[model samples]
Target: MLGFINGFLRRRQRERLRVAEFSSYWLEILKTNVPLFNRLHSADQEELRWRVQVFLAEKQFEGCGGLTITDEMTVTIAGHACLLLLHRETDFYPELYSILVYPSSFLVPVKRDFDDAPGIVHEGVDVLCGEAWPTGAIVLSWDEVCQAFSDDRDGTNVTLHEFAHLLDMEGGEADGTPILQDHEHYREWAKVFETEFTHLRRARRRGRLTVLDEYGAEHPAEFFAVATEAFFENSSVMKQQHPALYGELKGYYQQDPIMWLSRSDPVK
Candidate 1:
C-alpha cells in the first residue's frame, strides 16, 4: 500500500514537472548545441522537451574538477539523454539520480584479473570520457558531450554511450541486454544481438571498416552502447549496413530516426 502511494505521488510530482514552464533560454541552448533536436519532428520535439524538463527536475547534476554546472550544460545533457526515452514508457532511468560532470576526460582507477592467471590481478587507471555506475550516478565529460552533440552523426556520443549502460544496468546487470517490452521478444532479441555481436567481432578481426565502431567488439555491454550511438547518430548507414541490428534497435527504441531525418527539414 505504501509502495503504491509513493509511486502515485511520484507520478503526480512528475506530471507537474512535465507541464511546468520551460525556459526559452534552455530551449535555445538545446537548439544550438543538440543537432538531433532540430532533426526531430515537431511532435517528437515537444515530447523531448517534456522529458527533458522532468529529467532535469528529478536528477541531480554536479560539477567536478574545477567545473561549475550551468543551465546550458544541464539542458544539453538532459536533452541528449532523454532522446533514449522518447516514445517509450519509461521511469526516467529509475536507478539513476546524480550526474557528475567533468570539464574534460578523467582518469579512473581500474582493477581486473588476467583471464589465464589464477591469483594475479592487474590494477591501473583508465582514461574515460563517461561512465555509468550501478550505484546510481552517471559521470560524463562536458567537452566530449558538446563534441558528440555538435557532430550528431559521427556515431560517437559519450552521453548516449554511458546512458545506454544505465539502461542495460536496469536489467540488474550490464550484459548488453535491456529490459524488453515483452517476454517473448527476449528470444528474438537474443538471437539478433548474438548474431550481430559475432559479426562485429569477426569484422574487427579482419580489420574491415564497419558502420558500428570497432570498439563495440570489446564487450556485449559496450556493443549495446556503441550500437545506440549509431542508432541515433548514424541511423541511415546503420539501417543499410546492419539491417537486423537496426531493426531491433528501431523496435526497442520505438523510434525511426531515419524516418525522422527523411521527413524533417534541414537542421539549423
Candidate 2:
C-alpha cells in the first residue's frame, strides 16, 4: 500500500507539470501569434508556440533601462527562443537563470573571461547584437530583436545568434557542440562542419560569393551561429548546394525546413 501511494504521488506530479507547462496562456499566444509568420510549417510553428509558453513559465526576465516588460515582450522572446528547442528531447536551458533586455543598442565593456577547463578565452562581445553564455545569462536588445520576424528578408537575426549560442551550450560546453543522441551523430557532425567550415574560410579569403558567409570562418563557434541563420532562412538553397551538410542539419534540428517552402514561394 505504501509503495502504491508513492507511485501515485509521482504520477500525479508529472500530470500536473504537463498541465501547467501547456497552460491556457501559452495556448492563446500560439493560436494568435504563430500564423503571422509563414516561415515555419504549421507543425513547427505549433511546436515553437507551445515551447515558448512553457519557457516563459520557467525562466525569469527582468526589464531594465526604464522599459516595462509586458506580455507581448515575454511572448515574443519566448516564441523565438523556444524555436531553438523544437526538435530536442529536452529543452535543457535550466542553467540560464535570468534574461536582461535592453530597449536598444547597449555597449558591453570588453573583457576576457577564460575557461581553462575548455581552453575557451571568452571575449566580451561588443556592438549591437546578442550574447549567450554557458550556464550564464542570455542578453538581448529588444529594439534590434524585432527585425528577426520582419517580412523583409535579411541575413541576420541577433536573437537567433544568441539563441544559437544557447543551443550550442547544451552539451555543457560551447565549443560548437550540442546534444546528440548517439556517437554516430557526433562523427557526422564533425566531418560536415569541418568541410563546410573550410569552404566558408576559402570563400572569404578569395572574395568569392558563397551561401555560408565569412562570419562562419571566424571560429568553429561562429560557424555554428552562422549555420543556424542559414538553416532557418535559406534552408532550401543550402540543401540544394550542400546535400550532406543539409542532411546533418535536418537530423540535428529534427526539422526539415526545406519542406516548409512552397511552390508559390516567390523568393525560392
Candidate 3:
C-alpha cells in the first residue's frame, strides 16, 4: 500500500510539472537554433513544447571535456529528442535518465581479436560522436548536434540517431524492433525492414549509392537508427528512392516529413 501511494504521488508531481508553462528563453532557443522547429505546424510545435518541458524536467544533462551545460544546450537537445516523441503516446523515454554531452568526438574502448592468434585479443579506441545505451543514458557530442541543425539535409543527426536507439530498445532489447500498435504492425515492420536491410547490404556490396548511409549495413539496429535520421532529415530523397521503407517509417513516426519539406521548399 505504501509503495502504491508513493508511485501515485510521483506520477501526480510529474503531471503537474508537465502542465506548467515553458520558459520564454527556451522558446527563443528553439526558434533560433532549431530550424526544424519552424517547419512544424503550430499544433505540432505546441505539442513539442510540452514534450520538451516534460523531458527537461525528467532527464539530467551533464557536460564533459570542458563543456558547460547551459539552458541553450539543454533546450536544443531536448527539442531534438522530443521530435521523436511528437506523435507517439510515450512516457518520454522512461528508461533513459541521463544525457552526457561532450565538446566533440570522444574515444571509447573497443575489443578486437588477433587474426594470427585466435586466443589473443586487444583493446582499441574508437572515436565516436554519439552512443545510446539500452537503458541508462545517451552520450553525444554537441558539435555534431549543432552541425545537424546547420546542415539539415545531410540525414545525420546524432541526437535523432541516439534517441531512435532508445525507441528501438523500448521492447527490452535493441534488435531493430520497437513497440508497435499490434501484431499486424509488427509483422509488417519486420517484413519491410528485413527486405530493405537485405537490399541495402546487397547495394553496398555492389558499390551502389544507397539513399540510407552504408553504416546501416552494419546491423539491423543500426539500420533502424540510420533510417530514422534519413526519414526526418532527408525525407524527400527517402520517399523517392525507397518508397516502401519510407512508408514504413512514415507509419511508425506518424509524421510525413516530406510534407514539412514541401511546406518550406523543395529539398535539394
Candidate 4:
C-alpha cells in the first residue's frame, strides 16, 4: 500500500512540474528572426517554447560586466540555437555551457594579410559583432543579434552562422560535418558535399551567382555553414538551385521549409 501511494505521489509531482514549466508564454523564444516566427507551424512554435524551457534549465548564461541577462534574452538565443537541433539528436559540447554576451560590438583577435598571402599574421583585433569557435566558446553582441533578427537580408544572420559552425564542428573536425549515423550516411554525405562544394567553388571562380553566399567557396566548412543557412532561411532558393543538396538537408533536418513556405502564403 505504501509503495503504491509513493508511486502515485511521484507521478503527480512530475505532472505538476510539467504544468508549471509550460504555463508561461512570454518566453524569450518568441524574439526570433521575424520570418522564422511567421513561418513556423503552430506545433513547431509550441515545441520550440517547450524546448526553450527545458534548454533554460540546462544551459549556463554569463552576462559579462554588469549587464543583466533576462529569461527573455537567454530564451531568445537558445530558441534559435535549438532550431538547428530540432530534427536530430545532437550532443554539442557539454562544455558549451557558457554564452558570452557584450552590449555591442566587441574586439576579438584575428589574422589578416595583404596581397600575395597564403598565411596571415596576427595583425590586430577584429571589431566583430559575433564569433563562435569550435571549442564551445560563443561570443555575441546583443545589439547585433537584435539587428540581425530585424534585418530582412538573405545574406546573413550572425548568430545562425556561428551556431551553424558549432553544428559543423560536432564531428571530429570542424570540416563542415556533424556526426552521421552510419557508414552509408557518411558515404552519401561525402558524395553530396563534395559535389556541391565543387559546384560552388566553380561558380565563385567564374563569377556566377549562387543562391547561397559565395563566401562558402572559401572552404569546406564555410560551404556547409552557408548551405545550412540557405537550407533554413532561403529554402526554396536552395531547392531551386541545388535539388540534391536541398533533399539531403531536408533528410537531415526533417523539417521542410519549402513545404512550410508553400503552405503559408503569408510567409513568403
Candidate 5:
C-alpha cells in the first residue's frame, strides 16, 4: 500500500507538470535547433511539446568542460530525447534524473585487458560524444548535438544514441533487448537483431558498405542504439535496404518515419 501510494503521488505530480504551459521561447528554441521537430505531424508536435515540458521539469541539467547550460541547450536536448517517447506510453525514462553536457567530445578513462597477459590491463583515454548510465545520468557533447541536427539525415545523433541505451537498459541490462509486449515479440526481436548484428559484423570484416553504421558491430547494446539513429534519421534508406530491421524498429517505436517523410515530401 505504501509503495502504491508513492507511485500514485509521483504520477499525479508528473501529470501536474505535464499540464503546465510550455513557454513560447522554448518552442522557438526547438524549432531553431531541431529540424526533426518541424517534420513531425501536428498532433505529434503537440504531444512532443508536452513531453519536452515534462522532461525539462523533471530532469536536471548540469554543464561540464567549461560549458554553461542554457534554456536553449536544455530544450534542444529534451526535445530530441522526448522524440523517442512521442508514440509510446512512458514514465519518461524513470531511471534517468540528470543530464550532463560538455562543449565538445569529452575524454573518459578506460581500462583494457591484454589478451596475452593473464590479468594485466592497460589504461587509456577515450574521446566520446555521449554516454548513458544504466540508472543515473546521461552525458552528451553539445557540439555533437548541434551537428546531428545540422546533418539531419546522417543517421547519427548522440542524443538518440545515448537515450536508446537508456531504453535498452530498462530491462535491467543493456544487451540490446528492451521490454516487449509479449513473448512472441521478444522471440522475433531476438532473431531479427541477431541476424542483422551478425550480418553487419561480417560486412565490416569484408570492408563492405552497409546501411547501418559499422560502430553497431561493437556490441549488441551499440547495435540497438546505432540502429535507432538510422531508424529515425535515414528511415527511407533503412526501409529500402534492411526491410526486416526497419519493420522491427517501426513496430518498436510505433512510428513510421518513412511514411512521415513521404508525407512531408510527396514529390519524391
Candidate 6:
C-alpha cells in the first residue's frame, strides 16, 4: 500500500511538471551555452526539456565560493545533465540530491594510506574541475562547466563526466560498468571495454593521439566517463577510429549524434 501510494504521487507530480510552462529564456541559454542542444532533433529536444523540468524540481543547487546561483546556471547545468537521459528509462539520477557549484576550479583535500607500509598515510591537496560523491552530492566549477559546453567537439564536458559517475554508482559502486538491459550484455561489455581500455593505455604511453582522453586510462570508472564524453561530443571521429567502442556506446545511449549532426544545420 505504501509503495503504491508513492508511485501514484510520483506520476501525479511528473504529470504536473510535464504541463508546466517552459521559459523561452531557458531555451535561449541552451542555444547560447550548450552547443549540443542545437544538434538534437526537435522531438529529442522536447523530451530533454521535459526531463530537465523534472530534474530542476527534484534536485537542489547550492552556490559555493561566493558564487550566486542563477537561472542561467541551474538551467544550463540541468540541460547538459539531462542529455544523458535521452531515450532511456531514467530516475533523474536517483542517487544525486544536490549540486554544489564553485566560481572556478577548487581544491579538495585528500588522504592516501600506503598499502605496503602500515601506519603510513599521506595527505595532499588537488585542484578539480568537477567531482561526484557517493553521498548524493556533486561539486563543479561553474566556469569549467560553461567552457566545456561551449565547445561540443572537445569531448571533455565536466557536467557529463560527473553525471556519468552517478549512473555508474546507481548499481552500488563505480566500476566502469553500469547495469545494462540484460545479463548477457555484461560479457560483451566487459570484453569490448577491456580491449578498448588496453588500447587507450597503450596509445597514451606511446604518445599517440587518440579520440579518447588519456585520463581515461586511469581506471575503468574514469574510462567509462571519458568514453561517454567522446561518445556524445566527438561522435564521428570515435565512430571511425574506434568502431567497436562506438557501437557499445551507441547501443547504450540509443542516440546517434552523427545522424543528429547530419540532419541539423552545421554547428558553428
**Cα deviation of 151, candidate 1, in Å:** 0.4
Q: How does residue 234 of candidate 1 score in lDDT?
A: 94
Go through the candidates in order and give the clash count of each: 0, 0, 0, 0, 0, 0
| lDDT of each residue in 111-226, candidate 6, tens digit only | 88889987998999999999999999999999999899878898899999999888888877898998787789889989999999999999999999899999999999999999
Global lDDT of each candidate: 0.91, 0.70, 0.88, 0.72, 0.89, 0.89
Considering summed lDDT, which 10 consecutive residues are worst modelled in model 1?
A: 259-268
* Model 4: lDDT to the true structure: 0.72
lDDT (tens digit, per residue) of candidate 4 on 1-268 = 9978976875565345444555344442463444575567777766666555555665678786566887666766776777766646654334476788888888877677767766756478888887777667778888877776776347466677778777777776778776765667877888999999999999999999988899888988888878887887788778998999888778777778777666644432
**Tens-digit lDDT track of model 1 for 1-268:** 9999989998998888767887899889989888888888778888899999899878999999999999999999999889999999999999999999999999999998997997898999999999999999999999999888878889889999999999999987899999999999999989999999999999999999888989999999999999999999999999999899999999999999897678556543
| Model 1 whole-model lDDT (C-alpha atoms) | 0.91
TM-scores, each model vs. reference: 0.96, 0.79, 0.93, 0.80, 0.95, 0.95
Query: Per-residue CA lDDT of candidate 3, range 1-268, in tens?
Result: 9978977886787678656888888898998767788889888988888888888878999999999999999999999999998888887898999999999999999999989989888989999999999758999999988888887788888899999999999987888888986778988899999999999999999999877999999899999999999999999999999898899988888899888976754221
Q: 4 or 6, which is superior by TM-score?
A: 6
Tens digit of lDDT per residue, candidate 2, span 1-268?
9978976875565345544545466555544443223456656655665566567656888877777787766777777677667768874375777788888877887767556646555667577557787766888888877666553134456676788878788776776777787887898899888998888888889998766767888888788887877776777677887888778877887877666666344220
Off by over 4 Å in 1: 115-117, 264-268
- CA deviation > 4 Å runs, candidate 6: 1-3, 114-119, 264-268
Sort by lDDT, top down from the best: 1, 6, 5, 3, 4, 2
Q: Against the true structure, whose TM-score is highest?
A: 1
Q: Which has the greatest lDDT?
A: 1
C-alpha lDDT of residue 145 in model 5? 91
- Model 6 residue 165 lDDT? 89
